[model samples]
Target: MRLPLPALLCCTAASLLLLLLRWRRRRGLWKKVRAARQRQERSLVQMEMAVQRFREQHPSVNVTSILNLPLPELTEKLRDGSLPLEHVFYAYVGKALQMATETNCITEYLQESETQVQKAKPAGKLGLLYGVPVSLKDSIDCQGHDTTLGFIKNINKPVAEDSVVVQVLRRQGAIPFVKTNIPQSLISYDCNNLIFGQTFNPLLYTRSPGGSTGGEGALIGGGGSILGFGTDLGGSLRFPAAFCGICALKPTGNRLSKKGVVSGIRGQKAVAAAVGPLAKDVESLALSMRALLCEDMFSLDSSVPPLPFNEEVYSSTKPLRIGYYETDFFTMPSPAMRRAIRETKQLLEDAGHTLVPFELMNMDYTLFNFCVKGVFADGCASFLGNFKGELEESSLGLFWLMKSPNWLKNVLSWITKPFMPRLSAMLLSVRANTVDEVWSLHHEIEEFSQQFVAQWKKLNLDVMLCPMLGPALGIGYPAKLSVAVSYTMLYNALDFPAGVVPVTMVTDEDEEELKGYQGYYRDYWDRTMAKAFHGSVGLPVAVQCVALPWQEELCLRFMKEVETLVLKNNRLI
Candidate 1:
């Protein structure tokens, strides 16, 4: 049965050739990575020169005083001609550039913003956001800037036209000053990519400033930008806001248009993505939302409903019934996160608001069946398609899970079924689904959404308060804790309007208690949680406020209430 000498020699030569080819491909990918870094470096240098030139041209502008003014007051000043529009723009741009240098949060949009500043002269009547400097997430398209979404392949592909949201912001006199960084493929909670490097938390550099809205979080949290916009599918906006101690609103999917936001799964609608604002205060978020959800947005994209921000509902002073929960059943929140929810509930109750204990029905099944299964029914082929042969480090975990051969996955599931039942179940569930399976998954999602709404109605609640996915996770935690996104993903699955307001910070006491914490499942995720909060002291913790779909104004009102209480008590300034 032994092969002839010549045949064996031929096989060995073929194997060597294949190895050489693989090495060549890897070398090319690394070259692309280096080229991208160099390009970004050049852009940053050019931006610095532009900023210096601006500083020399406007010597007596008092940039510090301009940044001190809040968004509302700043708008009024700009309207009355007390503050020059160019001065206001440069003030924010200067602060933004400083923060971006420290955290690596900005992409290449400075030169374009300089042009925008020149074009922002006030007319007779000031627009809602006149002279305001607004930041945008990387995926949001600006006509001349590249919407990379942190992909090496998408580095130089400048979007030819602005997204509908950007156009609307401009129409309202908001200057789109900068584009922020994001996680690769805009999916993981950790924000790192080869294109722009990793964006660090301004408060704590060791931990993540959650993604894919992470760049916005760091800049706004660092007091660099007054308001910024980010898109969310699974906690992208809320998680970062919580981690960075800022305010953000994830409105119902249709409320804000998503016309030109670059997404990996752009066509996937099983769980729709939403564009929302992140800002320093709840009022700023409200202002941005009002400007974003306008007739202009609807006119550009007919899919957007012509629903304006309801002022009356947002200003309601009636006593409210609020449902509250500490955990979402998939993962137990950290001590600081749980404390944030408990304290917010206590504050609302003391403020004449009624609080009721609430639990999500079949949360575990809903997350796995609808959110997870529905989004990845095609085994993440669509999500992976945008990488263009370069795989980001953060995406390797989910990528491997989705790309593994069926036989290997089955074997792993079988082996782990005895001891690691939870993981075994997940392994079995992650795979390429059929057309019929996808359809059935969508049907189940509809049923689940209806059931959730019915449950809410039965409770007769005005709003619900819950914890975000633990306190801002430490660096490199998202790859291991992928399933821990259940809390925020639940809202997305139900299409609810959710907002996050910082209530407390992670203290030594919170970290000490987490050391002995035992999660509900006591599984791999729980173990990961235990280790993730070790160096997380002093990180901000926030709670989520949610309302039924299209009730964003109500959601913002509740967030404002919580924010006011937190500020008055000096719990968070």
Candidate 2:
């Protein structure tokens, strides 16, 4: 039966009212975001004018020579009082300004760096990084600066205290001079966001630098920063390092004080983010690790294990029993990355390290079940809470899918099963709904990790080598190629330490193979993967080094070994 005319009219009026309210709320969010962006633009202009004046006054300074110095030599000169601290700092500031201008990587200039360097000194035990200037990913807290992870609502709300990492850096006499851009919500690998715009790959203008640490990658890869801090959850640190031909370390979780390091999914410990450094070279990464694991960091945050940098483990000349895999079963690695692994394996063997074939196990259960499902146990309701009044980046589609109701996912999974079974299986894998379900998910994760440990012990492996995603994917493709991170995220699941070093570029043959790229499954995701690698020739590709938990120093050693071997081989050739 039809309702009375007045009651029907009332129902229609209420429906229209709700939509109007939604439209008004969305407009308000954009307005806040626009104001925040205007403030950033104004600050940038002021900083640029100040940089111009400094350049004119220091016209005779050899900024080029200073920028070219290696990290060790640069730090040594500053330590012995041979190089003026102010000169080196300004030189990087100049280059950093140029980098930010080119790629839109910088969020705000920490102009107070000038004041910090003036008072810098080789003052006792914690002065290992004396007079060094560094950059930070935007999610870290620095006193008096906003830690906007590219979200509009996060702007202008500066933190009251420094993050544990920042405090350690300052005490070690390293000046943190700039905060760089990240994807909105810090989820996607692409660097584009609504705030501060997109940060492009420094080498290939059209390619992505990779995220959520893409800004750090771009800056250091372009020679603007010698060392910079970044965090890796899935592949934040390593992806950018590989994509932009830099070096980075993603240490085991709970190894550092993450007190003020922000994450959208806060308090999720099943798979926590690991804080580490991105730099121009492996030695610079090692230097950063050594400085970060000091007494200052220990005292500031007690949760960090009181472990000092193990110099002996790093300096040991004993041969390693290394395990390696060219690719994983979850996603087919690009041809160039597989070649990178093989090349690295031969080089390591030449240097007296034993290499054995290693295959990844149980990714079908691990990828969507434990990681995607368990990582966001709340279905991302809690994370989505942060985006209510914010203009988020476009790449958060996955986050929303993860948050969808089980009934909806199941229906979609069933509908697509015949045509796209892998994706259907992925859709069905989002199982952690209740508290019991989450506990069960953890049990599965622990068991999977143990199985991997069993395999490692059986092989007697001290280190491992593997592929990192692809030869620098084109911009806007990482979201669909999410499965490619299986190579890296396996370590994250097991809480093992890992690092990436640039080793090879995509050769003519590599690109030719990429053209014939047939993915594991001929589904939507795979088709997108093919398109992502279509124009990726000449881009840098790198191999990943993995070690067990709490073996960060040893992991660094493995990375250094690869870097040295590759460079020596290149020189000989």
**Candidate 1 accuracy as lDDT:** 0.84
lDDT of each: 0.84, 0.84
Sliding window of 10 residues with minimal summed lDDT for model 2: 391-400
**What is model 2's C-alpha RMSD?**
2.2
Residue 410 alpha-carbon offset, candidate 2, angstroms: 1.5
Writing each residue's lDDT as its tens digit, candidate 2 over 149-174 gives 77777777999999999999998889
lDDT (tens digit, per residue) of candidate 1 on 139-254: 99999778887776776677899999999998998888788989888988788887788899999888889988999999999988999999989899998998899899999988
TM-score for predicted model 1 compared with the true structure: 0.94
Runs in model 2 with CA error above 4 Å? Answer: 1-24, 121-126, 392-394, 397-400
How many clashes in each structure?
0, 0
Q: What does the lDDT read for residue 468 in candidate 2?
A: 87
